[model samples]
Target chain A: MTAALAARDLVVGYRRGRRARTVVLDGVSLTLAPGQFACLIGPNGSGKSTLLRTCSGLQPPLHGELLLAGKDLRRLTRLDVARRVAAVLTDRHDTGRLTGRDLVGLGRYPYTGWFGRLEGDDDRVVAGALEAVAATHLAHRVVAELSDGERQRVMIARALAQQPSLLILDEPAAFLDVTARVELVALLRELTREHGLAVVLATHDLELALRSADTVWVLDAEHRLATGLPEDIAAGGALGRAFPTGSWAFDPVEWRFVFCGTVRGVATVAGDSLHATLARRILEREGFVVNPPDVGPGVQLAIEVLEPPHAAPTVIARHAGGVETHRALQPLADLARRVAADARPGETPR
Target chain B: MLTEERVAAHPEPAPRASVDGQAPARGRAALVFPLLGLLLVVVFVLGIAVGSVPIPVVDVVKVLTGHEPHGVYHAIVFDIRLPRSITGVLVGAALGVAGLQLQTLFRNPLADPFVLGVSAGASLGVALVVLAGASSEATFLAGLGGLGDVGIAGAGTLGAAAVMVAVLFAARRVRSTITILVVGLMVSYLVASLVTVLIASADGPRIQQFLAWEAGSFRAITWSQLHVLVPVLLVGLLAAAAGVKQLNALLLGERYAATMGVDVRRTRFVTIGTAALLAGVATAFCGPIGFLGIAIPHLARAALGSSDHRLLVPASMLLGGTVALAADIIAQLPGADFVLPLNAVTALLGAPIVIWVVLSSRNAGTLGA
Candidate 1:
């Protein structure tokens, strides 16, 4: 089958006049096969929304060809695109007295004739959409009264009711808590597989996207769009370039960003995972970089501990001047703070 | 984290729509239309029978059925009461629909033709011809006194159209409808000042004529005038009907509606145009009736408990007509010789309902802070 969505050298941005356009992303080409879940990542003001809007036909691209299910997007009317591509936008709305079922029913508008009365089949489609999102229990609830996660599900159901081949969402998980975001991404992924749809979502949940999305779309600091496997994109340092920061470091192995504090000392931690992790966190927070325990034992501060994940065991800190034992990481961190203030890392305390 | 599990088939769609609950709300909402329609008829009959002259209900029915009624009953029913009652239904239905559209279009509970300056625009049009027509005009234009009711109404429409154009222009340039609301208020103030200037320049005797119209009444509609009035009202209602789908989509706001294939600008244009037609034409004929336009839609929603425009359009029409008819009866005060101003009577009937809606629905999403 043809690619579910393809953009050829697409340039997206705002039009200042007839001849001048402020392009945000230029010469970008990307494709997603059916049943692929792609995440679009970029910094704020990086034109992710503009690009999504352009791809979904809500806005005209500054230049380029966008194809939806092998048809040129520019040639299709809104109704045609709406039939093929449904989007969940970021606009907050007050849906007064509209039940979840009723809100989902609105998704059938592209098929509903002028009067817009939902027929038997349309009703079934609405019901199916709600089921797909696992929101059947919420179907009778007033959409306005639902919690954030529930309402976002209903909004996604509204889009699904259109029965589009490709789904585009702009920040669908914006207000959701961590668990809700995970559940929502999983649901979208399942829908893509079960229904054979191509899904593109723009989100700020970087770890979740990297872990779950089959394809990754990254807009680098230069605003150039790159598409690759999530692993490839993460390993290639594109994520780092896109999300430039002063002190936070992306730990590729653990698949998370760890805050690296200013280093005033060098330290080594030798312990089980539980003690070592906490001990290292304390050292890092106290402006010391924690290295492995292999550096010559007496050369710098070194900590050794033995503790279960839950049990509190004593940690011994040894230095050139003296050795101190602490019951917990907090006091140890305080001591390290004082030691660093007294003398720099790799130097004996004055 | 994304994980691959053994493939399973899709969950089965629900066998039927959720029906165990919501039946009561649905049933009640379904019953409201016919009940309001029945109320409309009762009040229409009351509006006719309980005017300055207390023609008995029997004679009111007899005259309506084309039977000969005794002792000036026929003239009262045909020449005065019937026209007034018809005007009530048309004007009420028009204002109600227009108000519903305005509120939904701007997403403001307080938005109405009167609040948005459309009525003031129409009033300014009438004021120009009635108060200042003779003072300045090409002899190509005759005196205001000679510009029949139709000409005054035409003037009213021109004013409403002008203000509507400005409001639409602002809707395009301004992101927030609340800003448009404030601009509308200022525009009304400007129109009020102009009306004051016209009143200041007008001769003393003509002030009574102007005030009578300004006070608003259904009594001035003539049989010949209904020929002009009915068609215009019908056109307005039809425009509103054509826009029901777009308005429903708009309840989700413009961006979602656009993604759903709605032409947001065109929808806005049609909606504002419909509001202008109904409010302008009604104001042209009825002279700036207030409260009914704004209050009736909220009442419709409360009664039906749904914001779907399909239901709201008709519900507001019936409820508006009924309330306007009832208000007219109260204004006449039955046997009393002194008649209250129709605008005041409507305000008295409408203001509390509006206040209650705004207050009660403060957190109900419709009027959330």
Candidate 2:
């Protein structure tokens, strides 16, 4: 099967005035096959949007050949490209009085002749696109009234209404909540499998994008794009270089970046029991660098989880200032919070 | 009802509607057109009947039908009221379509033909003839005949077309719609200041004539002007009607419109040209008619409860024509000797609606503020 979209050493950028060209990305080559979900990840100003725009025919490539469905990109008219590729931009526009159905109906522009009158077939295609995106119920709701998640679903349905072989989106879930983000990614994954669509989405949601993507294209800070399977890319640790460690570190085992808070101070948890283990976990989570019991009371903040005769775990924090008592380990997590806030240096614990 | 299990991929083998199957009369758009058409006729006739002399509706109809020959009523209906009232309809409809196109093209709801400085450009064109040419030497104003209806109207068109070309050039260089709007407004201000300077150059009688023209009136339009007005306005309206697809895609903004195969640049050029032609021609005859171009599209959107241009374009035309005639009657202040300025009536009636739009926005986000 032919690749849905292929770019050979393409250069993407904008032309200033008569001669100056502002190059955003250069020497980029990639091929995306039908039925594959590819996510392009890069930091801001890394040229992800430019690449997506060039691929979807929204912008002319500065150099090199681009082929969409085996046709030279330059050879195709806007309508011809519309018939093959659909794009959803991140820009939020005023929908005003348009119903969800009205918005989705606009997607049939390439096929709808003059006047853009929706025929019966066009209506059904609209309904089917809505159904596929699970937005059938929102068909009559005015787009202005939709929540971000719901509006996004409607927008995706609009693109699907185009019935394109390839779909490109720039930050489609930029404004969605976590649940909505998951649902959107799941929907895109299903679309690739169910419709054989070559889908490419550029996004900041790294974990969500990587979770279900069949292919990953990682662009580093310097505009070097590397493409591979999600597992291979994660294991090879190219993501580390692309998005260098800052306040967060990437966990190789979990294949996701884990956010680390500022360590307030060292805390020694004195117990080998399950309760002690739970206490240590909470301390580390609250930005406490935990020390082993062998490091002893010199650590300044020492927490002991004594096995209680009662059901709850008895916890005690002996600091340089004083000793504090807690009936349970759960609330003991708040001790880290209070100390992190007011206990700068060897201050008294409240 | 074929599922993926039954027919392979869901996108394949869609249940295509047969040729006989067609779109249902969508609820609002269906009712809006004919109802607005009826209202248009009613207001237009009321316009003829409600003027100072108050020819009874029966006589107005009789004169319209040519049942009465060579009477005062005949002269009034055929020569005066008919031209004025029809000019009301023409000016209103032209501004309505032009205004609707501007609002969509800018994505700014407040945008109107005036914002483009088309009217100011026409004012400059008119001032060049009326002010500088009104002197005893006065050769340019009477290049055809003493700044008569045709000469002024022709100058207005020339001026507006010049601004239209300027705006189109500015649009090509500017990428954002917001920037284009600013460019158009600045150009408008620049042209308007030029017109003011010209006003200072003229003497008394010429200044009075220029002031009367600036006041904006439909009554000055004669049947002779209609011959020029109708065809020019028709081309603009036709251009608007043909741009339904382009306008609809444009609602999402230029980038999305481009990806969907709309020639975004061409759409911008055509939209600006059509808008300029409509407002330019109408202003040529009517002399700076205001509010209708901005207000009428909002009225149509409210009436139809839709932003779809097919519905908006026609609804605005009809509603605009009806409202213009109504405003004309009010400006005449039926049964009174003194007439009010058309601009006063249009602004008095339409400004509130714009205020309502501003207050009703849930936040500035919806207005692109």
Candidate 3:
């Protein structure tokens, strides 16, 4: 399938003064495959929103060519773009006491003639769009009375009513609560799969993007564009470099970063199947670590509570001196608590 | 948020369009109503029959048909009432069309000939001539007297045109609606101050004459006056009719109209120019007849159940004529020997409708969703 939107060496910015300018995107080129759910991630002022606006034709790029399907974006008339690329911006308009349905009907303007006539097919498209966003029931309510999430959904419904081939949403989940955020991500995924729409969304929630999006478009701090599968990008440490330098690290074990070096000597835990093999390896590496359970008294492992296969196990160590003889536990929570206790004075790990 | 979503789901179809979203059909249907033609017929007949010396309708018809009746009815029907009533019809239609165009152009319902300062400008022109006792025919030439003895009508036209020019210039520079309205009001005050200075300096006779004109009587209109007004009024009406399509497209706001390939700036200039001509000329001859222009368009929109100018433009013209003619009849109340000022009768009908519209829709900011 042809790329729905392609940018070639795009540079986007605005002039600050006669001689000064701030560049949002510098020589960035990328193509979005048809029907793919692409998520763009970047820190503040990293040009994510600017790139989206340039692609949607709302803003002009300072340098570069953008093509929608096979046609160059600059050559296509605004009306032509309206029919091809539908956009849902973050700006909420108070369109003077209009109803949800009234706002959606405005989406039909591109399809209508000079007198703004709407035919049967136009009405159907409007209805179908509302239905797709599952906001059919809210159609009768006034826009001013809706909650934030409801308003966002209505905005999406309005964009859908445009019936464009490509959908561009900027910060779709910005105002949504945590649960709504998750649901919105899932809904976007389902919509892309069902309609085969080339979806380009800008979001700050990296976890949700990693879980839901097929491809990730990273706008690094250096004003460069990078694209790859989410897994490959995460594994290649692209996210680590792209994000601003901070007191955080990519926790390889957890598959996402956490604020490391903030806590002191944090205890790590493993699942039942991985624990025994890990323990054996640790023993070979450090010779004094292995003390078989119920053995004689220099340092004894008195309790080796082993549950059935697939069940969790726990280990406790007893020492004559003030030392933790490597207290091993099957559950990570218990290990964390014991390690936290060991960090206190009087008890030290050998 | 869900409310907006819900509201967005059922976007209000632009007013007057059918389910298919086609241009309103009522406009085409309204053309056959022939209301103006009918009103002309009634007012002409009534003008002769209902005067101080009552001529029978049959006698009036006979005199108009040139049967050469011996009685005073012949002189009254053919020479006096016919011209006055025809003048009223044209002037009324002109002001109505102008008011509708101004309101639509500004997207302001309260917009009217006088409020936008066009009428004030026209009055200022007339005041300068009449108050100064200047018989400059070029400045105030369209009247019953020969070109040398210019009357209030001619001066009024020049003043209105002057105001139109000023307001149009201001409108071109400013995009904000409230600022434009404020500018129009300030211009009105400037013109009013000039009129005041002229009135203060005039002798008692000139001042009395100016006061009479300010009272806004239609009794001064004559056959000679009709010659100057009929053609101008007709041109103004035709210009407004041609503007309906563009006006309807403008209902979507300027940016949206531009995207739809409308040259918004050009359309605005044309519509405002035509509106200025209509108001200027009407105020020149008939003396700032109030209320009909502003009230009639809203009444037409409400009656037609649509804002599509195809129906609204003509509907407003007829309605304006009807109201103006009706006001003229009330001005000539049988019991009162002296006729009331035309504005008195118009305000009676116009004010109530405006108040009711405001009351019915608590928020005039948006049509009831």
Assess the local accuracy of residue B312 in candidate 1 as a C-alpha lDDT between 0 and 100: 89
> lDDT per residue, candidate 3, B198-223, as tens digits?
88887787687666677665567777
- Give the Å shift of residue B12 in candidate 1: 7.7
Worst 10 residues of 3 chain A by lDDT: A261-270
lDDT tens readout by residue for model 1, A1-350: 78979999988988876887898889979998889999999899878988899888988888889999899988898898988889997787889888888889888888898878888667667777877788989988888899999999999999988888889999988788989989999999998887788899999889988998999999876887778998898788888888888767777777787756455777888865777788887776666767834554433578988675566788888976699887777778777778778755443221
Tens digits of lDDT, candidate 2, B221-282: 77888887878887778888999889988888888888889988888888888898888878
| The 10-residue segment with the lowest total lDDT in model 2 chain A | A341-350
Clash numbers, per candidate: 1, 0, 29
Better of 1 and 3 by DockQ: 1
The whole-model C-alpha lDDT of candidate 3 against the native structure comes to 0.67
lDDT of 1 by residue, B43-137 (tens): 98888898767988887888888787655799888898898999999999999999999888888777887766888898888888777766666
Best by TM-score: 1
TM-score per model (chain B)? 0.89, 0.89, 0.83
